[model samples]
Each structure stands twice: as structure tokens, then as C-alpha cells.
Target: MTTEIATLGGGCFWCLEAVYQELQGVQQVESGYAGGHVANPSYEEVCSGGTGHAEVVRVTFDPAIVSYREILEIFFTIHDPTTLNRQGNDCGTQYRSVIFYHSPEQEETARQVIAEMANVWDAPIVTELAPLPAYYKAEDYHQNYFRQNPLQGYCAFVVAPKVAKFRKIFADKAKSA
Candidate 1:
């Protein structure tokens, strides 16, 4: 199967990772750091806001099953793109809304999607669009965090709601459990 990569940072990587993991076409969702100059930054370092990295998820998906636009549509729905450098209580540059496109086509699609979403939201869309940069996979514990820690406080209150919303709003797109 043909697979494409989409790197996105909407808030906590756990939230994005959890939602994307449930999407039908997704083959793998890796929590990671991107849009930074540092080499192989640790989660703690990125969280400090000193590494310039955003908490991002590298999603590998089959375009034949789910188009890039559809993935972007879900992203816009699941996170508050208007809130700069934060999503809910999560704060810092690492928590900013961003899309790191892997190709020219992806970049163009992101621009169009963001423009359309601007009309849908009352506030302006603040999601950053940039070419994909060096990406560092997060620590092992971070991968599939929600699935592994469903009862964890942050996973329960924060990530679970986003996952439920994704399932509720895009039931047809969700993978069968």
C-alpha cells in the first residue's frame, strides 16, 4: 500500500497521536518533535521551550483510503487552531498548532484547508504551515500513550475527549475496533 506522511502539532503530541491512531487509513502514528534546530531533542528539552521544537506526530497513512484533505479536516475539528502557542491549558511554543507538509502538493493542500477553515471558525486560523523539517521520535513511553494510559489523568480528561470527538464526528472514517 502507498503511504504518505503528515507531520502535525496541534497541542500535546499525545492528543494528536491518539486521534490519528484511530483513523482508518493511518498505518502508524509516531509522537515526535519537529520545526526545530536542535538535533534529536528530548521531550523534556522540547517542553522547556528552549529547543524551538513543537510537539508533533508523524502520521503514516494510505492516501488511497484517506486523502490528505480529509486528514486536515479532522485536524481542524479536533483542535483549536486559533489559539496560538497553546491548546487548552497546555502552553509553550511546543504546543502551537502547526502542519509540516512533506511535499509541494501537501503544502498547497494545507493552505487551501486552512483558508476554508478560516471561514468555519469565528476567530482567524493561526495554524502554522511549513515544509517538513528534521523530526525526532519521542521517547518510547510516549508512543500510543492514550491507548496505554487510558486511565491516566491527562489521557482521561484531555486525550480521551478528543478521541471520542473524532469517533463521534467522523464515525465512518474511524477504524473498526
Candidate 2:
């Protein structure tokens, strides 16, 4: 399998991690921080909005199974691309919508996808599509957050609904395991 990487930040990393983990082509999803000025910023620093980091997830997937466009499609569906620096009640710069493209092809696909999705929402898509600068894996506690803390209030209320939507809307693309 030819593995490709896609780094995305749309709301919390936990929500993105939960949704991508169930995708058929997805091999691994690492919750992290990206599209920021700081290097190796901690979650608290990101949350403070001083670090300028967005909570991101670096997904490893097989393009043969799911194209980069498909990944962007899922991303657009799962989060509010129209909202700037926030998702639902979670308000912060770290919760902003962004796509850190790994290649020229990915960059082109992301732009095309955003243009196509323009009619989907009344507001213009605010998702930042940029070349990936760097990715720092979040602290160990942040990895697999939803799976590890399923009973947590935020995971149950926010992340779970997103995951459910992913499974229901992309049923054909959902992983068997």
C-alpha cells in the first residue's frame, strides 16, 4: 500500500482523530499541533492562543483506497469550514479550520474541493489551505483521546456526534474493524 499523509486542523484534534480513525483507507491518525509559529508547543500554550498553533491531526492513509480529494471531502463534512477559529462552543485559535497539504497535488485538490463546496454553506469556506510547515505529535495523553476517554464529557458530547455522523454519512467508506 502506498501511504500518504494529510495534516488537518478543524476544531479539536480529538474530534478529527475520532472521525479519521474509522475511515477505510486510514492507517494511523496522530493528534498534534500545526500551522503555527511556535515549535513543539504544548496543548496549554496552544489553548492560550499565544503559541498560534492549531490543534491538528496527521493522518496516514493509503491513497489507493481513498484519494486525497476524498479525505478533504470528509474533512469538509465533519467540521464547520465557515467558522473562523472555533467549532461549536469551543472557541479559540487552536480550533480553527485548516488543511496543511503534503504535496502539490494535495494542495490543488484542496482548493478545488473548497470551490466546489462554496454552495454548501452561505458563508465562504474559511479553511486555510497551505503547504504543511511542520507537525509535532501531541503529548501521549492526547493520542487516541476519544478511545481512551470515551466517557469523558467532551468526548461524549462533541467528538462522539462527529464520529457518528462520519459513520452514517460515509458508511461505505467506514472501516470494518
Candidate 3:
């Protein structure tokens, strides 16, 4: 199977990781850091907002099963792109909405998707679009955080809702349990 990668940061990486993990064509979803100046930043360093890194997820998917545009559509639905440097109570530059495109085609698709989504939101879309940069995988404990810590406070209260929203809104695209 052909695999394409999409790196995205929309609030907490846990939330985006949880939702993308359930999408049908997504082969792998890795919580990570990107769009930053630092090298191999730790989660705490990123959270401090000094490393310039945003909490991001590197998603590997099969384009034949799910197009890049469809992946972007789900992304827009699951997160508030209008809120700059934050999603809900999560704050800091690390929580900003961003899309790190891997190719020219992916960049074009992101631009088009953002433009279309702008009409849907009353506020302007603030999601950043940039070419993919150096990505550092988050700590081992962070991978599949929601699946591993479903009852954890943040996972339960925050990540779960995003996962549920994706399931409810895009049932057709969700992987079978």
C-alpha cells in the first residue's frame, strides 16, 4: 500500500492523535513536535513555549483509501482553527493550529481546504500552513495516549470528545472497531 504523511498540530497532540487513529485509511499516527527551531524538543520544553515547537501528530495514511482532502476535512471539523495559539483551555504556541504539508500537492490541498472552511466559520481561519520541517517523535509514553489512558482526566474530558465528534460526524470514514 502507498503511504503519504501529513503533519498537523491542532491543540493538544493527544486530541488529534486520538481522532486520526480512528480514521480508516490512517496507517499510523505519531504524536510529535514540529514547526519549531529546537532540535529534539521534550514535551515540557515545547509546553514552555520557548522551543517554538507546536505539539503535532505525524499521520501516515493510504491515499488510495482516503484522499488528502478528506483527511483535511476531518481535521477542520475536529478542531477550532480560528482560535490562535490555543484550543479550548490549552494555551501556548505549542497548541496552535497548523498544517505542515509534505509536498506541493498537499500544500495546495491545504490552502483550498482552509479557504473552504473559512466560509463555514464566523471567525477567520487562523490555521498555519507551512512546508513540513524537522519532526521529533514525542516520548514513548505519549504514543496512543488516549487508547492507553481512556480514563485519564485530560483524555476523558478533552481527547474523548474530539474522538467522539469524529465518529459522529464522519462515521463513514471511521475504522471498524
For residues 1-177, what per-residue lDDT tens digits would candidate 3 score against the true structure? 799999999999999999999999999999999999999999889999999999999999999999999999999999999999999999999999999999999999999999999999999999999998899999999999999999999999998889999999999999999
Task: Compose the digit string of candidate 1's lDDT tens values, residues 1-177.
Answer: 789999999999999999999999999999999998899998889989999999999999999999999999999999999999999999999999999999999999999999999999999999999998899999999999999999999999999999999999999999999
- What lDDT does the true structure give each of the candidates? 0.96, 0.93, 0.95
Question: Which pairs clash in the backbone of model 2?
Answer: none
Cα RMSD, model 3: 0.5
Give the range where candidate 1 is weakest over 10 consecutive residues by summed lDDT: 40-49
CA shift of 51, model 2, Å: 0.7
For lDDT, the strongest prediction is: 1
Ranked by lDDT, top first:
1, 3, 2
Output the lDDT of residue 150, model 2: 97
Query: How many clashes (backbone N, Cα, C below 3 Å) per candidate?
Result: 0, 0, 0
